[model samples]
Target: MKRVFIIAVAIVTLLVSAEAQKQKVGIVLSGGGALGFGHIGVLQALEDNGIYPTIVAGTSMGALVGAMYANGLRPQDIFDLVKAEEFDKISKIITPSGLRRGSMGISDHKNILDMLDKYIPANDFDSLKMPLYVCVSNISKSQGEIIHSGGRLHEYLLASSSIPLVFEAVELDSMYYVDGGVFNNLPAQAIRDKCTYLIGSNVNPEKYRSPIKSGKDVAMRSVSILIYENTKPGIEMCDFMVDVPVNYFYSPMDFKHFYEIYQIGYKAGLDYIKEHPEIVRKCKGKRPDW
Candidate 1:
């Protein structure tokens, strides 16, 4: 009887291990300022429900949180970090002059980079426990690229978050970089073919569409189209699009608004997964072949 019990326990352990290996989840995070910070609650809800991504690809602010998550920080910890005054101080550098002149005068860029490094040192993306891919806009070529294999985490984060004139373009290895959203807003294309399942945590509302009228608008739209076409295909897609007003992106970030944004994203994500039982089932290791 003792031998039989031990065998049963070993069998159960092996089954659990196999299930874990079979589950390949990819989380795609979108850009939206303090809006993007809402991803914290979305991630929290997923984790609460036993859903954790095996891989993650994020744009702009999403990349910042994703990088921290990849480095082993939990959602609550990320929230705490953001709530800290130190993080808010970084945004103060984006002045009206910075936007008009295309320069953040003081190079708070360095300060931002330094702060991130203090908490999470620059490490190879491939070396992270869970692989994280950061989507960045290649300014020189006006294209989108995923920084997955290896690079300074700070550089990747900076490149992904640099919102054109608002935040000065970062120079690295002789190339200028800007926000990834300019090309791929949600960055769904970054991990489409790399995983069996994908969860797109988008802060941008689904109904919001760009009203393009000018020459520059057309060019931006064209770039978006090209990047969208290049994004990989053939993955199970689960979308969580938060309903935030267009004006919110232009507003200043504060604890009150941050909390509200988080609630909006968290509820949307929770409701989405609840309605889509298939997504929940996949995350919990119930689907083996799909």
Candidate 2:
């Protein structure tokens, strides 16, 4: 009888240990314009390994992807949306007013807003399946704002990704907002306190290998330098990071290379997962065939 009691106690203790080890994982996605499309591939790889984020935080392009995922659209669905020719038309169709913006931006904000309206199912944070924190730069205040709620979801997405000089700033509640990458490109700090484990995906290239030939290239390279400098702190906060190898040649507006970039992201994610067996162990019983 004593032996039976000892065995029961041991089993209970093991079960308790397993339960305690189950952690709330949060993913932080960094901004990289069209390179951000790679985030979808990383997310797909995570799902394939049965690792789903309990919370997600992002800046700029990251915010757009994170918001869609938080609304319950699978990565594959997002991939399809981005790869479709319709997306190319909508994103590139510039209005005469947009072209004449002189110093504001070359593209129309309404085009992307219309795209978001058609795709995203939810309009508010509370309605989402998972908590999503979107980081945007409050240009009026010269500060970064982390938006977890309030205002329209699509507007927040637009504001978060509104690249300075490329797309016009989004106005919300009488405040002007622009790309979050100008402040915090990798917003790991936003979800650091919310999750027990953190995963970060950085799509920015480590260095610019090509010459800056155009005004657009100059803007992109300048932003890349700023984002790269500010990303160190966020990198240190992650338990694991998937670094997608996007290069200088792949401009922010290179929608044509979305599939190639996405595949690179997937491979990077798989490589990270293989290297971190502890992550796999933690997600036991949930593993899917890769």
What C-alpha lDDT values do all the predictions have?
Answer: 0.68, 0.79
Candidate 1 lDDT for residue 244: 36
List runs of model 1 lying over 4 Å from the truth.
Answer: 1-23, 85-107, 208-256, 285-290
Tens digits of per-residue lDDT for model 1 on 1-290? 99999999999999777666642787887776566767888888787777877678888888988888887787888888877634644354344434444453323366567668776765567666677888898888878888888768788788888876567787787888888877776676666656767787766553443667679657755654543443322112444333333323323234246777777667776787777767777765421121
Q: Give stretches of model 2 more than 4 Å off.
A: 1-23, 88-97, 101-103, 205-220, 283-290
Q: Estimate each model's TM-score.
A: 0.73, 0.83
RMSD of each: 8.1, 6.1
Looking at model 2, report the run of 10 residues with the lowest lDDT sum: 281-290
Q: How many backbone clashes does candidate 2 have?
A: 0
Best by TM-score: 2
TM-score of 2: 0.83
Query: What TM value does model 1 have?
Result: 0.73
